[model samples]
Target: MSDPTPVFDDLRDESDELDRLVAELSPGQWALPTPAPNWTVAHQIAHLAWTDHSALLAVTDADAFRGLVEKALAAAETFVDEGAETGARLPSAELLARWRQGRAELDRALRASRPGARFPWYGPPMSAASMATGRIMETWAHGQDVADTLGVVRAPTDRLKHVVRIGVRARDFAFGAHGLPAPAEEFRVEILGPSGDTWTYGPEDAPQRVTGPALDFCLLVTQRAHRADLAVRAEGPDADRWLDIAQAFAGPPGGGRSPKGDAE
Candidate 1:
């Protein structure tokens, strides 16, 4: 694939940006409820910290990581919430320190892996580049929760290109995850990036097409917002169906967030 080093750099930059943002929050602010159900700012950072530590282990020690994954899978339903709740109980300073350390170690471990080596994940094994890009996407998505909680409107950046790429790439995976066969036709995506440049993916002449602002597309694929709230529009039956269940991250099918103004 492309040079992963730049993507790794971007991952670290995203982590650093989040670290700086959270560092400025007061204890009360850290406890502020976020858009994610039953999760606060502290819970968000804690989740990131726990996942980063797990990812570091995945890269540095495959056997141990596999065991951990097995254990987590055995307790799949509660595992995520348990980890986040446990970590969120830490003192604010300690929570921040652990998250910072986990991210740093993860970056280093991913960089040290062989160029084409794959690491086990909740879904399929991911190469170093995919792992880095996944981390960046998670960081940005969770950061959005934190930003929304604080009423901060983060300016869009080219870094979002990674998120959009993954969103487009996951089209087939999304369908298959729901036990549906992927459509035979290629789906075209045309996104207007933050910088006013058109970011296009897939064959330009494809019959299926999805078009919208890059930010809205990212939000949709990430499940951060309901499709009703975004400006994305899809043409063709396959493209329309793909948008209904598009998920950039791997997992059991997620129940996407409710539409704007809906009760939680």
Candidate 2:
């Protein structure tokens, strides 16, 4: 995996960016719809904060581990199963504040933990480093949705590797999530990042170059943007379709891609 320190840094930077944006929003702005259907800007922040809270609780207190994991899963389930009514009715500000605190705790836990410390995540045991990286990616990717809704663009940061890693590793997952078979052959992923970090996955020369600004690539692959809307490109039919169904985040498939532009 990429150096763990930078991963945390990217996550931290992204988290900070989102915090800054949300902290300054007027009360009315908090209720605006993001690219995510039915979710308001406040809901997006709440989800990120809640996710971070789960991460921190899992790492810092072992006795609460199993229960925390279950709670996290249940929260995702509730979010997915609930409709607009749920979002509209939920306390948006409280959700955001809860998550904000959760993230603060997670940042502390990550700093104190060892690199390979194990944690219970979505599947298979993963290292603390991986979990931290996932948090960074998720936080930033969601932050992008909020930023898009506000029409405020955040400059691509070097710390995007966190999400880029998930985007590459989760490529094969697109097929199954879409009810299609996993590819018979492996696909390589190449990311041209903002800070000149070149990330490659699969074989050295496997047939795919996700050439474009790293931010756009990450945003698109994370299902935050439509492939056609961004400068991102995918070679071969399989690669292209993967972009159509690509989802770096966990939980049920987010409603199909937005039509792009104002449709966002």
Candidate 3:
């Protein structure tokens, strides 16, 4: 795989795009409920900001970040939601400023890290490139909540290639997280990129395959949409199970979004 620094740049660009979108919102708009149960637009941004700050700490101050991680693990069940709640309590201006600062600092810290260095995270330590990709995936996912709440459509982009790549690379982790052993046979993944070119992974002779649009695969792996709403098709038992529980981001298994036509 290519070095992900360029992809990291794209990630920062995605964050800037989201920042622009929320920068124009009114106080009432900030309060709009998002797809995440009990979380509003503010909550979504707040969570992003908190995680960005955490990522920065992970890079710049490992000891302090470890302390923070210990506290979060102690309240594992509610830690994520609690951070968002605390952040959402800030005024709109303050919240936006904090988010902007946090992301900028995170980008800088990531770039300054030594080549091939790994940073501590809630789960395993991640390289700078991996961390950047995760941040990009998260920013895009949360931005989806804001867009959906506002009834806005975000045009699909080739940037989704990064997300798709991460999803494919995380295949084993997905199965392992659920206490299932990865299948011995490698799985093939072929998805149509936004540019109309095909992006593929795994060996062509692999018995198991997943084929779909890049956007759908990205949404599925990010847990932003249910597999039922996507056009992803899987062959073989291993591929089927992977599609069922695939997650690109770190942390515990998530409760994926409901299928279309189902009440939230």
Candidate 1 has its poorest 10 consecutive residues by lDDT at 255-264
Residue lDDT tens for model 1, 1-264: 567899999999988888878998899999999888899999999999989988898899889889888989899888888999999999899999999988888888887888789988887899988888998899999998898888888888888999999999999899999999999978889999999999998899998899999899999999999999999999999899988999998777777889987864
Q: What is the C-alpha RMSD of each candidate to the true structure, in Å?
A: 1.6, 3.2, 1.7
lDDT of 2 at 89: 53
Q: In candidate 2, what are the lDDT values of residues 210-257, reduced to their tens digit?
A: 556778778776877767778778787887777778778776566646
Candidate 1 residue pairs in backbone clash: none
TM-score of each: 0.95, 0.85, 0.95
Candidate 3 clash figure, as a count: 0
lDDT of 2 at 109: 78
Candidate lDDT scores, in order, read 0.90, 0.72, 0.91
Per-residue C-alpha lDDT of model 3 across residues 1-264, encoded as one tens digit per residue: 466679678988999888888999999999999989999999999999999989999999999999989999899889999999999989999999999989889888887889889999987899999889888888988998898899888888888888898899888999998999998888889999989999999899988999999989999999999999999999998899899999998778999998987965
Each model's total of backbone clashes = 0, 1, 0
